[model samples]
Target chain A: MSNPKEHLYQKTAFDLVSGFKNKQWKAAEIAESFLNRALDTNKKLNSFICIPHESILDHATLLDEKRNSNEDLGSLACSPIAIKDILCTSGISTTCGSKILQNFTPYYDATVVEKLKDKDALIFGKTNLDEFAMGSSNENSFFGPVRNPWNLDCVAGGSSGGSAAAVAGQQCAASLGSDTGGSIRLPASFCGVVGVKPSYGRVSRFGLIAFASSLDQVGVFTKDVRDSALLLRIISGQDSKDSTSSSNFVPHFLDSLSIKKKWRIGLPKEYFQQGLDSEVRQALSQSISLLGKNKFEIEEVSLPHSDLSIAAYYLIATGEASSNLSRFDGVRYGYRASNPKNLNDLYKRTRSDGFGYEVKRRIMLGTFALSSGYYDAYYKKASQVRTLIIQDFQKAFEKVDLLLTPTAPFTAFKIGEKTKDPIQMYLTDIYTTAVNLAGLPALSMPCGFDSKKLPIGLQLIAPRFEEERMFQMAHYLEKEFHVQNSKHHIVL
Target chain B: MKFDIQTVERIAELSRLEFDAQEKEILLQDLSKILHYVEKLEAVDVEKIQPTYNIIESECFFREDQISVHLSNDSLFKNAPEVQEHFVQVPQMIASHE
Candidate 1:
């Protein structure tokens, strides 16, 4: 028989919920198994910045008591979910992998965190991330980079790398991550897990520390599409706290999973051009042929403005980042510089000492972009170009139901591989950023593993608030690909 | 698109950040490279397209201005670096003339 510990950790969140409800396993046993796994693998993966070991067990034990008393249980009764460090967790430090907020703890929980608690999901831990969610690789984190579980030397894609790695490493049943300019999807692609970035206002951003307001979104990283659907339903809805949140009807995502339809999948000709790794390209083509044989129409579509996405994304993301991050001045909370001669000295010294290199670089870029003379040329021009990119997606979707592309140009690269050159690192998000620009819903799931045994992710982009379609297609393709059966060759 | 030391310094001042000489040199190179790349946006034909300042098309949501329970002072100051009686402490804003 398979090891009981291994079997417990391997079960998906859906399986865990059903098994716990049926008394197959106690909630404490499930929590202990995953928590121990997280603690055991954290040394190798560095996925969690803070794993509140005792509190998680206490919460799990409370669930067991409720079940024993014949009390009604929440939908996610005994599920263990890891949260990205960017979200505020009451009494737990929400570091965002930066020294700026190292000792800071919020008095209130983020809207998503509160929702998860209401559903009785164990708040497993706070996962690591790029400092202020700035970098394409987790190397920019102050806590050090999160190593990819598949290959220890390769960097887990970021700034949600820790959340992705935690799910892939079996450290948590699911995780919550924020995506601004491909943070969630790129790491999910690299780590071979399901990463979903809902449309701009699909989820509330109230307690999520802002990176770039227009593009920032709270999303999920899960082992399977069903778990993604389940978690997405629980955390999504209109919230009074976040004005940008949509009032659109939040559907029952889990109930719609079995609905099948042949979606017209578009392959953007520009995304298929040079720079895509041959192995990833081959894997995508194979997946395409499989879909084509299964009656899904595949066609070549043009997103003419794709080449300009990166330029526009950087100008806009950094410009907003500069303004949003201005809150970190030596003030009421967070790190403060020592021995300041005056208020201005304190502001400058505290920020300089607190922020990591990438955060400072982006701040400079944003300050320059929004400066008096250059605003029209840089930020305004990029915003206008963003309109064209949005229009490009609008026109493409008029002909196709969904778009398919390689999530990243290549798989996870070695740590320190592209850190020396900021531009080289920024180019990694070439295929994933435009989706954010248009505020569309997209997901990344494993298609195949490269020859090196590293996971290759295929991204599916659907129109705004049409996540249900993306889920149906991804779930269908996931079964066809037998993604669940694929073994993770984790180093630890 | 290239940034000189003086320009980097000006931007850093605006951003309230300080960098030593070597750090400034590196920032100058990195910012120059990134800005040069983004300069390509000038070539895109966007004269007709309106800027998308806000991607969310939702209307502004307003709520009642009613009194409600909020975080107490103790909880609000829980994360403050330095706190005095019901207030956050910081460096002296006004310098005394010597």
Candidate 2:
């Protein structure tokens, strides 16, 4: 019998699925092992807000029965995956990390959840997130901040902080996260994992609690690139429930990963500006050099409007957030205030009591930006600037096959450092937010570590429908950077 | 224009939120700074530019809407704070004209 601890805890999704296929481990044994490890680690990491103990074991027994009979199985048959609370799971509490929806149990699974279950993946528990996916740090979560696995003093990036921390700390094989701005990539970077934010429309947003409807995209956090690609292939596709979902055929991302890289990659000058820490910049430069030696050409490109991305992102994101959140009126669903005398009172008291401070702040800013007299002056004009930012990426893509940038300006800071200053918190997304505005696909891979041994991510971005090219480059860099097995390499 | 106390209160009311006296004072100052920065937008010439919303521009793609089984009324009201006759109860809408 295998020493089931590490195998159960931190095995990559790819390895686990392959093992399950060969009947090397029974599904029940695998599920129990992970559940045990998750329960043990969650105490320190606070990565999981809910763990579906009884249901997961029940599902495992069924999968083990199917395996013993030699029945054909789905892709993720018996593999464990955690979901950020933002995605609704049928019969499970889908809080979106807000008190407003604390008691709300979704009657239907989101399209993504339905697909995951159809593939036979175990629905692990819901993870914590910023209330409504608003904050860059997980501290804004109503359940309490999720601690970074790499260092307990630091924070796991948010609003997908719980998912990233869970995956990083061996709580799950893979976890799904939503990235409206940098929620997915930021946490993935800080937690030292592979995160891919698929192109807008790649994944269905049918039941995800909306943050910025246009910008919000669901992504995955995995211990390895191949696992990320596998999860991406499964979750992506058009859906009738989501209008923005692309009708295009879902690419065979696993097959795409096999394609060799023989193209030019651009490093944006604006991303490597003065504020970037020298160590992080060096890590990116070294990665570029490694790629150069491997026959991939690298060049310096300019995205002049890049500096305005943070401002424009905040305006556009908050403006849409304001509009999307208006549905929580304490009338149709979710929380209702205690003895609300009137409709307006119900709306006010419910929202005031349900939402957290950061959520309230964004809603206010968004409402102000989109208000009648200021619409043209703020929202519309910010959109034009957003267009300019998109053009910057478009113009650069013409000259290079892909664009490269640091995933974040600096490495993850200590918890409570940025809590007081909201602007500084927003600034953490400086590099990752631009891609959301442009509707492009991007991935954040671990590039280097800072002086304190925290991970820094180098972002790889590609043009529309060019995720294949982006993956090819990422695979090459994964080898070139020599970052493999450097952090959290499970030897079991 | 910079937002005064009255403007702030009005916007707060419009947003269905409450702002205390100190918060209103702070909001006034913050709004002034933001408005000053956002004033750059006025210089842009958008006379002929139509506002662009929904960049993807997809038509509604519905499922086979042949009564594809709706949620049970019990499940719908399971989390409701107030329910009456299998329907969610809310405060009556008091019309201004009425």
Q: Which candidate is the best by TM-score?
A: 1
What is the per-residue lDDT of model 1 for residues B29-58, given as tens digits with 9 covering 90 to 100?
899889889878878887888999888776
Superposed model 1: Cα runs more than 4 Å off: A1-6, A483-488, B66-69
| DockQ top scorer | 1
Q: Using Cα atoms with residue i matched to residue i, what is each candidate's TM-score against the true structure? A: 0.98, 0.95
Model 2 residue A300 CA deviation in Å: 1.0
Error of 2 at A215 (Å): 0.6
Chain A, candidate 2, TM-score of 0.97
Q: What is the TM-score of chain A in candidate 1?
A: 0.98
Lowest lDDT 10-residue stretch of candidate 2 chain A? A483-492
DockQ, per model, reads 0.87, 0.46
- Candidate number achieving the greatest lDDT relative to the actual structure: 1
Chain A TM-scores of each predicted structure, in the order given, are: 0.98, 0.97
